[model samples]
Target: MDVSGTRATDENTRPPAVIKATARQLLVKVGAGGLSPEAVAGDSGLAVAEVEAVFPHRDDLLTALVIDAYNESAAAMERADEAARAAGASAGGRLLAVTRALRKWSFDNSGEFTLIYGSPVPGYHAPQETVPPASRTPAVLAGIVRSALENGELTPPRRAVPGPPLLRPEAVELFGGLPPAPFSDVIERGIVLWSSLIGLLVFQVFSRTHDSVRDESAYFDFAVAVAAEGIGLVVPLDDGAHTT
Candidate 1:
């Protein structure tokens, strides 16, 4: 999975495995700002021209790092979701698990997280190549919502209590160019829940709490519960039984 989803195997498109592996190691140490083809080559004991052939510019190297970060984080979320499913967790539980996985990923790879989600580097406009890789995590969240919808556990928004309004373009793109069925009307709420999940991580990762929040874990659980409900996920009962 070279992020392009093409026929380019590890033997062809990118540099050698050691080069990329060593580059990531250096990325962790130096952060995105300090990253350079020459620097990576110097540390990896490989020729700079060899690295340049694979990554001609600084932005190319940055793009690779960004793709790697997104893939890793998305994999964490998907793996956690699978684990939750294996343990007989409901859709809501799976949502919580994936949310927890994302937060944990941010903490574990703080530098990488900041590299993509933090302040944009000047003049570094991500090319179209970044879109699919960037969509991976959101696709996982959408899957949780879709599962709940398919199981009839998600409640549709009522006319009177309409959950915000999504503009035409975004709604259409929310689900593979087709607005979410069954829960189509609540796409705006879904958008809020999705963005808010990331916002919560930004706050926690940047220590925006100023040390006031005694238990971030509890707070995260609370937020996940809210997001679950926001997307209309039915909660299981006290006896660990689903009422859906």
Candidate 2:
């Protein structure tokens, strides 16, 4: 099961226990500034040469960690969604629950969130082949939008109305009735919220601003509130009502 060895099984076929353990340990110690392969090898009790043999470079380890963090976030969101559904909440309620879960995840994993969103490491090209299917944040946000529309939470633009509203879609089910806005807009706004939250934490983390702000939990709560406000604007509560 140790992948950092010669003649190892295909990565896809390897058990995740070893990799996950190593990654978890590294992340706990090194908050997403990224870790060297040598560091990971020492922590994992594997030989430095063997770590290089498997990961080849620091980028591989970072890419793996990013993918892992995203998967964990998505799973958490899914659980929140399921809980909301069980409570007989509408799709809009479920979407908000998922969004809140994501915000909480970001705050909890600030290091991982910063690495994935704040900045990309130099010379670290993500291996397209190794990227997870559900790790794309934009696509996930788009799915939430579609769900809100279907749940009668958002309104499509009305054609018969004048100007911009007239040009918008009239209903959620009708593709043509959907707004002309691109998916990128939603993704960008989400990233902005995430980055803003991280920036606030980074300032506090590095002692760059507000020397008096010693309570990390208080700052995190403020950041979450800001992120929630951004989501409210991007998704808009009135869309569903407008459509109805």
**Global CA lDDT computed for model 1:** 0.72
lDDT of 1 by residue, 1-244 (tens): 2322222245654455545666567657876777788888888777889877767887877777787788889999999999999999888888878888898898888877888788886778878778777888888887877677777768766542345444567444655454355566555666678898888888888898649777777777777677667767754433332211
TM-score versus the correct structure, for each prediction: 0.79, 0.57
* Model 2 / residue 112 / CA error / Å: 2.4
lDDT score, residue 77, model 1? 95
**CA deviation > 4 Å runs, candidate 1:** 1-19, 22-30, 158-165, 168-182, 234-244
How many clashes in each structure?
0, 7
Choose the strongest candidate by lDDT. Answer: 1
The alpha-carbon lDDT assigned to residue 225 of candidate 1 equals: 78
Clash pairs of candidate 1? none
